[model samples]
Target: MLLVTGITGHSGRYFLQELIKNKYEGPIRCTVRETSNTFLLDNSGLKIEKVFGDLNDQDFIDRVMDGVEVVIHIYNIHHSPNIVQTAIEKKVKRVILVHTTGIYSQFKYASKGYKLIEERISQFKNDTKCPTSITILRPSMIYGDLCDSNMSKFIKMVDKLRIMPVISRGNSLIQPVNARDLGKAFFTVLMSPEKTVGNAYDLTGEMPIKLIDVFKLISKELNKKTFFISVPLSLGVLMARVLKILTLGKINYIEKVQRMAENRNYSHDNATYDFNYEPMSFEKGIIIEVQEYLKKKEGSKSK
Candidate 1:
């Protein structure tokens, strides 16, 4: 039996697609909040047991862990400790987690909590008392769908505004792995646990791209000539603060500006070698995402 969480989330939705694509014959179970939109899961054409409960609930976790051999947790990384503990207690054979590359961020506020969560997971893995083998896959900025607030928001902003404001002259490098690519990677790891277990893989995109180039690519896809105004990092942060104040905290992007100034490029050579993980190029992936976004926009208008 396989227990998969976050089946209704951004990456999870695509991961479910991979499972369907591969024609996985295992008994699958998923835990979701009562209000979580299960449209995709319902239409996935795969038999999945949907458990209604929070992962934070110990009783619920124990109930769902019954007869579960392997667990694929695609939910928030913050809940890893509890999940890992329960898996260990339940004597689950293997556990796969979707962590983030934010642990590598220079910003203390952003990386600190991830580091701590990872540390606890490490402790569990090192413990001789534990029987579960854990593999952690850390992915960079994930985009490719409307559920992605990062690139989807960027795409919408670029479409709505003629001039795009960038921080650090839009020179900072970012490697955004498509959600579909990430989902495929998860399936790849699931099939090849010998190569993935007890190790962590960085799942970045095909290449690192400048933020400026990203804006230009979207503009090209939209067939709109866009202009760029590079704002100093310090000034961008100040403006975000001002806007947050003016909006009565409805809009806050201070951390967003700070994060934009930092380079978020990572190597996936290990993932490629281990599980034949090949991600799509941003140029190609962004085109699909833009098309999907525009289609959805047109869809909403007709309703």
Candidate 2:
């Protein structure tokens, strides 16, 4: 039996898709909180057992771990460390932890609260002594259908306002990987335990490009003209704070922009060498995303 946490999330859903496509014979179990909606998985051909409980509760964790052999820990909430601890206690043989690349240096631009979370994750990684084989995957910005990350928002803004926001000189480089590719990387690592265990791998797109160039490419794809405006970091932070005061700042949106402005690079050589991980090109991912967006817009118009 294999357990998948956060089964409804971006990467989790991708993982499920890949698993089902490959026709893995093991039983799959997913854990979700009370507020999480599982309707997304309805009618899907994948055979899954859903466990509803608070991940922080050790008893609940044990219940989900019953008869589970390998576990994929993707539930990155406040109780993530506790979940890992419980997994160790349950004696699960293999565990794959999907961490964020932003948890590295990107936290410098994050809000105070997120920075603390990053610190805790780092501390937990350093302190863990579990006998189970663990592979920590740190992936860069992930974009795909239904994604609302910085890239998606920028695409929407370009379609709406016919302009793009460029922080500072817009020279900061970003390696945005497709969510499907990220899923494949996760699946590859999970299947090849020996090469991945006790290692941390960074998964990123094939090429890193500047923020300005990214927006321009999207604008070209959308057949729109983009007007670029530079905003200083201090001013951007002030604007974000003001937006928060007005309840207008989207939690993940502001944080993503701030992080992108920092121009951090995540290496993927370890992942590539270990599991033969190959992320799709940025252009390929963007093309797919734009097509989806267009289809969605047409559907909305028809309705």
TM-score of each: 0.94, 0.86
Top candidate on lDDT is 1
User: How do the residues 175-208 of candidate 1 rate in per-residue lDDT, one tens digit apiece?
Assistant: 9999999999999999898789889999999999
Which segments of candidate 1 are over 4 A away from where they belong? 43-45, 243-252, 301-303
What digit string (tens of lDDT, one per residue) describes model 2 on residues 1-303? Answer: 899898788887788778878877777888987787787555466677888887767788878887778988876745556666666678778778787776666455544544565465556456657556667787787887646475788788888875556788688988988889987888888888878876878889888888888888889888887788888877887777777777754443566557657876677888888888888888888988888898889999999
Q: For model 1, give the RMSD to the true fold.
A: 1.7
The residue pairs that clash in candidate 2, if any, are none
Clashes counted in candidate 2 amount to 0
